[model samples]
Target: ILDYFELTKVDKEGKMLNIYLQEKNIAPDGHQHQDLESKGFFPEVEIQDFPIRGQKVALCIKRRRWTIKKTGEIISRDWGLIRKGARMTTEFGLFLKGIFG
Candidate 1:
């Protein structure tokens, strides 16, 4: 799933719920992204009840962004799809790949 695409793992800075990449590098993550993506979701799942505590996708920028860490290929641009419930590392890394690639 997510691992199949190769995503970076990143964390949000400070107490805020926003996350971003440092130097636009591919974000990193520890989950079996491959397993999740294999569920056939990838960047196409309806997210509600975000899995993270006190974290929510409230901004447009927080909704779209994801890529393949290996090739730096963009998978989606929906922030709501990238934040919280899903791993931010792969999303951020792919975003970095988008601009840098």
Candidate 2:
């Protein structure tokens, strides 16, 4: 999909474009958590937030699957682009902030 969309060069080493840091683990309200519980685990895990432009922002969420590795490691991998408005990016960052900080 990256190739077809040409989001990055063909010889790029990895798909990661940027990594952000967040400080808290904000679980979706109980109802939403229950809905996705069967599909995956959404534990209240927290991490350190990154300082950007002199302001602290949310942390990176390393999504992990429990069935494969019990020791705790991010397992799921997904990447995509939403071409609409910069607002989307800002909104996403804000969402992450709400979830983490």
Candidate 3:
């Protein structure tokens, strides 16, 4: 899960911590093909994470894009880090549910 993203930056706003991460540039099929071209990044997404030292943490993920030279098809990695219908990570969501469910 952590291998898919690279830590880009970290910012602290008052009691909140913002972590910026950029998805690694690799083929969506999990292969490093020579025909792949680097494209722009997708819109940034924010997901809440477990707090640290009583400070809320937010993950700002930037998903990269690529175009296949052979087919001209744009593709990107589908990282299912966030749980369905929730803005927090799957691990964090499960932790909260276990404590309060």
The lDDT per prediction is 0.37, 0.33, 0.88
Between prediction 2 and prediction 3, the one with superior lDDT is 3
Clash pairs, candidate 2, are 21-58, 21-59, 22-58, 22-59, 24-100
Report model 3's TM-score to 2 decimal places: 0.90
* Winning model by lDDT: 3
Model 2, 1-101: lDDT tens digits are: 22222221112124322343221223333322322221253442223233456543333333323222333333332322322433234456566669999
Per-residue lDDT over 5-89 for candidate 3, one digit per residue giving the tens place of the 0 to 100 score: 7998999999999999988765676547548987989999999999999999999999889888888888777777899999999
lDDT score at residue 59, model 1, on the 0-100 scale: 19
- List model 1 lDDT by residue over 25-100, tens digit each: 2233543262222112233332232235766532112223445556555553223344544545456646656889
The per-candidate count of clashes, in order, stands at 25, 5, 0
Q: TM-score for all predictions?
A: 0.21, 0.23, 0.90
- Give the candidate order by descending TM-score: 3, 2, 1
Best by TM-score: 3
Error of 1 at 91 (Å): 16
